[model samples]
Target: MKSLSLHFISIGGSVMHNLAIALQQQGHKVTGSDDEIYEPSRTRLQKQGLLPAEMGWNPANIHTGLDAVILGMHARKDNPELLKAQELGLAVYSYPEFIYEQSKHKQRVVIAGSHGKTTITSILLHVLNYHKRNFDYLVGAQIEGFDTMVKLTADAPLLIAEGDEYGASPLDTRPKFLFFQPHIALISGIAWDHVNIYPTYDSYVHQFELLADSLPKAGAIVFDDTDDMLDVIALKEREDVTRQPYDVHSYRISNGQTWLKTKSAGDVPVQIFGEHNMKNIAGALAVCDRLGITEEMFYEAIQSFKGAARRLELVTSNDQKTIYRDFAHAPSKVGATTAAVRQQFPNRKLIACVELHTFSSLNKNFLGQYRDKLDQADVAVVFYSPHTLEMKRMEPISPQEIITAFDRPDLQIFTDTASLQTFLESQSTAAPSVYLLMSSGTFGGLDVNRLGEQ
Candidate 1:
C-alpha cells in the first residue's frame, strides 16, 4: 500500500472519520470536508490534523494529483466535491469500495444479520486479540481494548468486518456487506429492520440471501439454525460453499452468573450473558474454528470478553440491585435483551424500559413486530418523544396505539423524558431487582449514571 493523497466527502461521519485517521496513520495524505461535524469525530480529526478548515463541500480540494476521492454515505450524490471529481474524471469510490480495494488480498470474515452482528464480530476480535493474532477489523461498536472501530493494515492476513445490511452510499443502494465479498461469513439472525430502505419483508431478507450467495468457492457461511429465515437460506443446495449451522452453546446460570460448559475447560466463567449472546458465542466459535482457533483457545480468550459497548452494558451495581444500559431498539433485539435480563436474574424483579427512537421502531406499521417483546420483564415501560416524531416527520402515535401494537394492556407508555426518568428513579430504590434501559438514543438527555445512583 503506497502513500497516496485521499479526500473524504463527509469526513465527520463516525466510521468515515475513523477511516480517515487510519489512512492518515498509514502515511497517506488525507483531507476531508463535511457540512457539519459533531463531538468525538471533530476533536479526533483536529488531533490528527485532518479536520477541515471550514465546513461544507469545496471543489477546490479536488485535484488531478490525488489518488482517489472516497465518498461517505452522509454526502449526497450531487455533492459539489463529488461533481468536481466526476468532472475531472477522478476515481470516485464509496467508503466500502475503497475498503475492499485495500483489503482485496486478505481473507475477509463478515458477520451479517439484523441483530447480533456487533456482538459476534466483537467476540471474534476479542478472541483474536487475546491470542496476540495480527488481524484487521471493522466493527460497529467500540470494544474495550480497540481504539478504533475500523482498522486496515498492509500485512494482516485476515479482516473481520461487521457487515451492515444498510445501503452503502447514496450512489450505491446495495447493502454494505455486498462490497466485502467475504471468504468466511456468519449470519447471526435476520429480522426485518431499516424500514425506510427495505420497505417490504421480502426485500429485507433478500439482502442477506445475496450475501450468502456471494461467497467464493469453498467459502464458509456460519449461521444460526434457530432462525427460520436463516434455516431456509442454509438449506439451499450449494456445493461451492460450506454451510455450518450453530445453536446456543452449552451454558448454565448459577446465582446470576452465566458459565459456559466445555469439555476441555470446566465451566468457564464469562462477563457477558444472555441466550442471544450464547448463540452469538456459538457463531463466533464456529467462525474462529474456520480461522484455525481451537475450542480450547476460544474459551480461554472468551472468559475476559466484557462485550461491545451499549449491548447490555453494565452501568452500575450494588448489594441488592444491578442496572444495565443496552442499545436494543429493534423488535428482535428488544425481545432478546429483555428476556436475557429476566433469565439472568429470575428471582429478582426485573424492570425494563425501552425508548422508541429509530425510524423503524417509531413507525406505526412496524410497531406490531414488538408485540410480546417486553413480556419477560416484570414491568415493561416504553418512552417516546413527540419531538423525535416531529423531527422525523412521522405521524404522532398515542398511548392506546402503542398498547394495541404491543398487545400488552399493562404496558406503561411515556411521551416525555422527565416523566419516564421519574418512573425509573422511583423503581430504582426497590431491593433485589434489575433495571434495563434500552435505547439507541439518549432517552431525551436523561442521565443513566444519575438514574442508576437513585
Candidate 2:
C-alpha cells in the first residue's frame, strides 16, 4: 500500500482521532483540525505528533494535494474546512466510508446493534488475537491487550469492525454500519435508541433491515433470536443469505462467581458475568464459527476475557462489598445491567444508580421506555443535571415527570450531585451490598474512587 495524503475534519472525536493515528502508523501522511480536543484524544494526538498546532477549523488546512478528507460526525455540514474541500473538488469521505475504502479488499465482519455491539466485537478480536490470526479491526472501546481502537493493515485478509447505527457524518445521514457492506454481520439485538436522529421506533429499526438486505450471495447474518424485532428481520425472505440465530449461552453462578458451561470443556470460568454477556458470548461464538474458530478454542480464549472497558467493569471489591461502574444509559442497557447485577448477588442488597445524560434518556417523549427498567435493583436512584438540559437547549424536566415515566413510586430522584452523594452515603449504613454506578457521563464529576472507599 502506497502512503496517502489525508486530512481529517473534527479529528478530536473518540473514533476519529484513533482512525487518524491508525493511518499515521500505517505510514500515511495525516493532518487534522478540531475546535476542541479533550483528554486522551488530546494526549494521544500529542504523543503521535498529529495534534493541530492551533484549534478550530482553518480553510487554509485544505489543499488540492490531499488525496481525501475524512469527515467525523462531530463536524457540521457547513464547516468551513468541509466547504473548502468541496470547492477544491477533493474527495471527501465520512470516517465509515474511509474505513470501507481501506478494507475493501479484506473480508469484512461487522458487529452491530443498539446494544452489545462493542462487547461482541471485542470478544471476536480477543479470540482471533489469541489464535495469532492476521486480521485488522476497528472496535469502539479500548481493550486490555489492544493498544489502539482502529487498525488497518495491508496484508491482513480479515477486518472486524463494530458498526454503529448513528449517522455516518454531517455530510451523510445514513447509519454508519451501512457503509461496511460486511460479508458477515451480527446484529446482537435491536432496541430503539438515538431518538433524536431516528424519531420513530420503526425508523430506527429500518437501518438494521437495510443491513440485512445488503448482504451478498452466500453472506451470513448472525443475530439474537430472542429479540422479537430481530427475529422478524431474520424471517425476511433471503434464500441466498444464511441466517444464523443464537440464544444466551448456558451458565451457572456459584458463590458469586459465574461459570460458563461448555459441551466440550466441562466448565469455563470467565471474569465477566450477566445474562447479557452470556448472550454476547453466544453471538460471538456464532460469528467465530463462520470465521473457522472451534468451540474449544473460543472457550479457551474467552475464559481470560475480562470484558470491554466500562461494560460492567469492577471499580473496587472487598470480601463484603463490591462497586461496579458501567456505561449503561440507554433503557435496554440499564435494565439488563441492573437485572444482571441483582441476579449475580442474590444474597446481597443491590443499590443501582443511573445518570440520565444522553439525548434519548433525557428526552421527555422517550422517558416511558425506561419504565420498570430498574425494578430489579433493591434500591434505585436516578440523577439528571438541569445544566445539561440548558446546554442541549431542551425544556427543563421536573422530577415528577421522571417519577411518572419510570412508574416507580419509590424511585429516588436527584437533580443535584451533592444530594445524590448524601443519599448514597446514607445507604452505606445498611447491610453488605453491591453498588452499580451506571452512566455514559460522570455523575456530575462524582469521584468513583472516593465513593468506593469503605
Candidate 3:
C-alpha cells in the first residue's frame, strides 16, 4: 500500500469517522466533509485533527490530489462534494466497497443478520485483541479496548465486519454484506427489518440467504441454532458452504456476575450477562476456533468482555436504582433486551420502556411482531414521537394500536416526551428497581443519563 490522500463525503457517521481516523493513523492524509457533526464524533475527529473546518459540503475540498473518495450513505446523490468528485473523474467508492478492497487479500469474517450483528462482531474483536492478534475490524458499536470502531492496517491478515442488511450506498441498492464476499460468516438470527425497504418478511429473509449463498465453497458459516428460520435456510440453500450451529452456552449469574461453563475451558466469569450474549459468545467462539484460536484462550479473552456500547449498557446504578439503555428497536431486539434485564434483576421491578422509532417498528403491518415482547417486564411502556412519524411520512398510530400490538393490557403508551419524562420521574427509586430504556433513536432528545440520575 502506498501513502495516499483520501477524502470522505459525509464522514461524521459512526463507521466513517473511525475509518478516517484509522487511515490517518496509517500515515494517510485524510480530509472529510459532513453537513452536521454531533457530540462524540465532533470531539473525536477534532482530537485526531480530522474534523472539517466547516459543517456543510464544500466543493473546494474535492481536488485532483485526492487518491480516492470514500462515500458514506449519509451523503445524498446530489451532494455537492460527491458531484464534484464525479466531475473531476476521481475514483469514488462506497464505504463497504472500500472495506472489501482493503481486505481483499485478508480473511474476511462478516457477521450478518437482522439483529445482534454488532454484539457478535464486538465479541470477536474483543477476543482477538485479547490474544494480541493483529487484525482490522469494522464494528457498528464502540468497544472499550479499541480506540476506534474501524481499524485498517497494511499487514493485518484478518478483517472482521458487521454485515448490515441495509442498502450500502445511494447508488447501490444491494445490502453492504453482499460485497464483502466473506471467507467466514455468521448469521446471528433473521427477522423482518427495514420494512420500508424489504416490504415483506420473506423479502427481508432472502437477503441473508443471498449472503450465505455468495460465500465461496471453502467458506464457513456459523449460525444461531436458536433461529429455526436460519437453520432451515442454511440446511436447504447452502450446500457448498461448511455450516456450524451454536446455541446459548451454559451460564449462570450469581451475585451480579455471569459465569460460563465450557467443556475444555471450564468455568469462566464474564462482565456481561444475558442468554443472547451467551449465544453471542458461542458464535464468537466458533469464529475464533475457525481462526485457529484455542478454546482456552477464547474463554480467557471473552470472560473479560464488557459488551458493546448501548446494548444493555448500564448508564447509572446505585444500591436502590439501576438504569440501562439499549439500542433495541426491532421486535427481536426488544424481546431479547427486556428478557435480559428481567433475568439479571429478577428481584427488582423491571420497567421496560421501548421507543418505536424505526421504520419496521412503526409500520402498521409489522407492529404485530412485537406482540408479547415486553411481557416479561413488570411494567411496559411504549413511546413514539409524532414528529418521527411525520418525518417518516407514516400515518399517525393510536396508543390503542400500540397497546394491542404488544398484546399487553397493562402496557402504557406515551406520545409526548415530557409526559414520558414525568412518568419516569414519578417512579420510586427508594427500592431497587431496573429501568430498561430501549430505542434506536434518542427518545425525542431526552437526556437518558440525566433521567437516570433523577
Candidate 4:
C-alpha cells in the first residue's frame, strides 16, 4: 500500500487514537484533530509526533491533497471537517469502513458480541502469537504482548478484529461489526446493551440478528449455543453458511485454580478463572479451527492465557485476602463476574462492590434488568455517583429505586466515592474474603492497590 495522508476527525477516542498511531506506524502520513485529548492518548500522540498543533476541528485542515478523512464516532455528522471533505470530494470513510478498505483482499475474522468481545479476541491473538502465526488484529483492550491495540500490515493474509456493537461513525448508524464482512465470524453471546442506541431489548437484540444475517453464504459463524437468541439465529443460518455452536467447556475449579478438560491435552490448567471464560475459550477455539489451527495446538497455547485487562483481572492478593477489579457494568457482565469469583472461592466471604456509571446502568428502565445479578456475593453493595447521573442528564435515581431494581433488600448504596472508599477501608480483610470491585469506569479515581492493602 502507498503512503496515504489520513486525517481523523476525533482522534482522542480510545480506539480511534490507537488506529491513528497504527496507521502512522505503518508509514502512512497520519494527522488528526479532536476537541480534547485526555491522558495516555495525549502522551502517546505526542510521542508519535502525530498530535495536532491545536485542539478543535479546523475546516482549513481539509484539502484535496488528503487521501481520506477518517471519521470517529465522537464527531457529529455536521462536523466542519466532514462538510469540507464532502465539498472537496475527498473520500470520507468511517474508521471501520477504512479498516475494511485496507483489508478488503484479506480474509477477515471478526469476534463480536455485546460482552466478552475483547477477552475472546485477546485470547485468539495470544494463542496465534504463541504459535508464531503472523496475523494483523484490532483488539479493544491492551494485552500484555501486543505493542499496539491496532495493527495493519501489507503481507498478512488474515485480519482479526474485535467487532464492537456501537455505531461505527456519525454517518454510519449500523453496528461496527457489520463493516468487517467477516469470512469467519464469532458472536460470543448477545445481551441487551447500548440502551442509548437500541432503546428496547428487542431492538438491541435485532442488531446481533442482522450481524449474523449479514455474513456471506459461504462464510462461517461460531456462536454460543447457550444463548436462546443466538441459538435461534444459528438455526436460521443459510444452507451454505457453516454454523458451529459452542457451549462452556467442561471444567472444574479447585484450590483457586480453573482448569479445562481438553480432549487431547487432558486436564489443561489455565490462568483465567470462571465458567463464562471457559465459554470464551470454546468460541475462540472454534474460530481458530476455521483458521486451520487444530484443537490440540490451541489448547497447548491457551494454557498460558491469563486474561484481557479488566475482565476479572486479579489486582492484588494475599494469603487471606484477594482483590479483583473487572469491567462488568452491564447486567449480564455483572452477574457473570460476581458469580465467577464466588464460584472460584466458594469458602471465602465475598464482598462485591459495583459502580453504576454507564448510560444503561444509570437509566431508570434499564436498571431493573440487573435483578439478582449480585446474589452470589455474601455482602452486595452498589455505588453510583449523583454527579455522574447529572452529567449524563439522566433522571436522578433514588436509593429505593436501585434497591428495588436488584431486589436485594439488604443492598447497601453509596452516592459518592469518599464514603464508598471509607467504608471499604474500614472493612476487615483479616478473614478469607474476596473484595471484588466491578466497574467500566474508575470508581471516582479510587486506587485499587491502596484499597487492597488495607
Each candidate's clash count? 0, 0, 0, 0
In candidate 4 the C-alpha lDDT for residue 284 amounts to: 91
Off by over 4 Å in 2: none
Whole-structure CA lDDT of model 4: 0.90
Report lDDT (CA) for all predictions: 0.92, 0.93, 0.89, 0.90
Decide which is better by lDDT, 2 or 4. Answer: 2
Estimate TM-scores for all models: 0.98, 0.98, 0.96, 0.98
Query: What would the per-residue lDDT of candidate 2 be over residues 241-310, giving only the tens digit for each residue?
Result: 9999999999999998999998899889998899999999999999999999999999999988989999
Kindly indicate the candidate among 3 and 4 with the higher TM-score: 4
- Model 1 residue runs over 4 Å out of place are none
Locate the minimum summed-lDDT window of 10 residues in model 2: 422-431
Which digits, one per residue and each the tens of the lDDT, describe model 1 over residues 161-225?
99898878888979999998899989999999999888899999999999999898999989999
Q: Model 4: per-residue lDDT, tens digit, 198-265?
A: 99889988888888888887898899999998988878938588999999988988798888987788
What's the distance in Å from true for residue 374, model 2?
0.7
Ranking by TM-score: 2, 4, 1, 3
Clashing residue pairs for model 3: none
Error of 4 at 183 (Å): 0.9
Best by lDDT: 2
